[model samples]
Target: MFGEYRTLSAKPGYSYTYTDGWTLSANPVYSYTYTDGWVYHGRSRYSCESVIRIILAETSLRSTVQREDALNNKIRAAKKLADIDSNSSQLRQLKQLEKELEKLKKTRADQVRTLYEWECMLRVGSLRRGYISVKSNPAWYLREELVEDCISRGGCCSRDCGCCERRRLSAKNGKGIGHCTLECMCCIHDQGSEFTAEEKKDFNGRFGKMLRSNNPAFLLRITNAYFSKPLFWKIKTKHK
Candidate 1:
């Protein structure tokens, strides 16, 4: 006579099985076992913030470019009118438009410089803080997802999304929630080697050129390309 028997055990977190016959065997199974800590979670948060900042900066740049273009068109129209009629009023109007164009160019340069500086500050802060822990609970992830969805859809229109509130808070603090503040002296210490002044200037120059470029589409493309790259935390696996 021959006989065979099998036993199976299952639990919320894990499972196992055993079989007895001509041969015996045991098997173990686990549903989910990976735990992500502060570094992993913080990196994700920072990456998302970076992407959002790039998008916002690009949008602002595009708007400014459009305004500059409109002003140029107006100046051209004024010049053409002056050329055809040669009246004192037309001449004055042409000169005024020229002065306005110069002011607009200066304003655009300042805007670009400000955006570049903000980007530098963000990167510098990240380097200094390393990855600080934050609340990565389900509720937090849900809120983050909601915000991302709203951004993808152009913007959140409903108050329930809390997008406006989040923006207001960020603006008030000049940093994202859960970020380590300058007051946290320990946290302000550089996690990596500090960037040299020359390196910092070079970085600013590169971004300055990109931001000042008249081609809005090219700038948008570059921004999108940057955000499309895989984040470091995504590809890294930790064994525990």
Candidate 2:
């Protein structure tokens, strides 16, 4: 149940009229539905609508950090928030990230006791591994909507240089990958900066909010993207 790249209508009360004739209106508090059991089963992570999670989590460079620290501090699990320094940056380094990721998977496997409910409450990490890791094709990762999401946030994808589509990560050994990360060179070149640890946390947290949010398409994207075998349910977000 991966998401296809579609131009998301962001006007008031965006609606999705699926091919099966179900009309869904999207609101931040919108929800995902099972819809006659047209759903994927026995999957742990990844939505079929894969566009690379880094863009979703790294955020556009134009992002401004809200003073969520104060708000988060009030929560019982705020320290966990404080302790987070987004590993999204490390993900860009390619070779450096393998061992760290393997360790994380094992840890996540343990913590996924009640999957969906747990994710809804607090989504700390991202599902960066798409359904397939094609290793370096911009076309593979370039879901334009995601690029637009990056552009909206003032990332390198927003630029005319085509950096987002360039194979810069591991190109020599034929494993070169593309797409923007928190530490993209062009992004750092133009913006003259990379995300600070807190900024990356804030950036990553914003995407986490989307997963935890009620936006139907968004929730569906995440649920499909990061499915954890938890019980799925319908969340009604239609307005009267």
How high is each candidate's TM-score?
0.35, 0.38
Model 1 agreement with the true structure over 52-71: per-residue lDDT tens digits: 35444544543344445546
- Deviation of model 2 at 75, angstroms: 41
Quick one: best TM-score, which candidate? Answer: 2
lDDT (tens digit, per residue) of candidate 2 on 170-196: 332322233455545566668766568
Off by over 4 Å in 1: 1-43, 47-53, 124-226, 230-240
- Show where candidate 2 strays beyond 4 Å: 1-31, 34-138, 168-178, 221-240
**Candidate 2 clash figure, as a count:** 11
